[model samples]
Target: ILIDGALQNLDFSSGSVEFHNLVIERELNQKVMGGTEDEIYIFYMRFRRGIRVGIRLSKKILLIQLEIDSGFRNGTLGLLGTFNDNQNDEFVLPNGTVFISGASQTDQNLHLYGLHWRTQEISSLFKYDGTQSWSSINNLTFVPLFFNPNLTAFIPNATIRRYAQDICYGEGLNDPTPEQRKPCYFDFSVTFDADIANDTEKTLKTIDTAKKTL
Candidate 1:
């Protein structure tokens, strides 16, 4: 957490804290987490002139909500991509190249675009404890994007992709829709668990509710 313009390492296991009018709250809501998220914390901050940010943490989820005035439109770029109305221009590289060999939102294009924006530990702005290093992900369920791209061990296969599509677009889900398949595929690729897509569904709904209320 960054407080008073200083970078501070925060531990939310103890209790909630109020600093400089920012609220760091801890709440237990089993229903919302599908009775699996043991730890849940919500941090909300409001900036002057209608720039607000909300961060919600669950067991295996980190959701972010942003509210910015249209005045700053098309003025930002990062993992979330451009904030402009043109969605086709997203996945742009640092060199401002939107397409290399071809255009469109293909897997190859997205991989290159996301890889360009990947941050290194040395260039990170936040503090780190160094307890869990990126190199120690040998036994993790999913490999981080920092891993070597040449290895296909962590990449999704045709069968896994089919399963993710079925679970995300399947009927009787949490408002399952065709458009939601992208996020669901991401979660599925990470965990290789079809049920993981449910978390993405719930998170989207949570974001929508926050937009309406705050």
Candidate 2:
């Protein structure tokens, strides 16, 4: 990852290190600026003015949460959407197409919103193995999500909603709220993997506790 201007190799390292402006602050007490917890790596950055970013990375997920000052309100665009304190115009496309508010987020509309914002991965910040290229995987008429309505047209006998709900809400985890468990439902429904949702749940909990420190 690019911290300030230098590149960092955080793939295997876990200890505290300070090299120039790059600082890896381990999770200790409540003053953690950023560090690693288990296999998850947390990185926090506070730029000039009032722009803050918290990044949590694991093998299965990458969460980048942005915290900006109110001065830049309505001054940004793209996948973050129009931040004018109005939820109605959240999904504005590059060509000025908007999935207007009050329209239920169906599988089609959600795919439209997601696919519109994907850019060509010309370059990457980190090194990895056996990664698929955008062109190799991104087909013109392909969608990664299957639990929603679009999949039913092809598979008439598909039944995933009840199992997904049971794993997400009925697994006896009393800590995460309904909002927090929403990711688990979607993840389980998409991949049909019960263990993959742990990444989302852990990332959310860590963000909740470390938000104040960031």
lDDT scores of the candidates, listed in order: 0.59, 0.58
Residue range 53-130, candidate 2, lDDT tens digits: 777754455668888889889876667778798887888877876764575665567777877777656743433335
Q: For model 1, how does the per-residue alpha-carbon lDDT over 1-214 read when each residue is reduced to its tens digit?
A: 6554456887667656556655465555444434464555556566555576878764456778887878778876756667898876655677776653344565655665666676666665544444654445334343344322222343346555456555655543332344444566567666665455776766677787899998
Highest TM-score scorer: 2
**How high is the lDDT of residue 18 in model 1?**
56
Estimate the Cα RMSD of every predicted model relative to the unseen true structure: 7.7, 7.8
Q: Model 2 off-target regions past 4 Å? A: 2-39, 120-142, 149-165, 171-182, 198-214
Q: How many angstroms is residue 86 displaced in model 1 relative to the true structure, after the best TM-score fit? A: 2.3
Query: Best-fitting candidate, measured by lDDT?
Result: 1
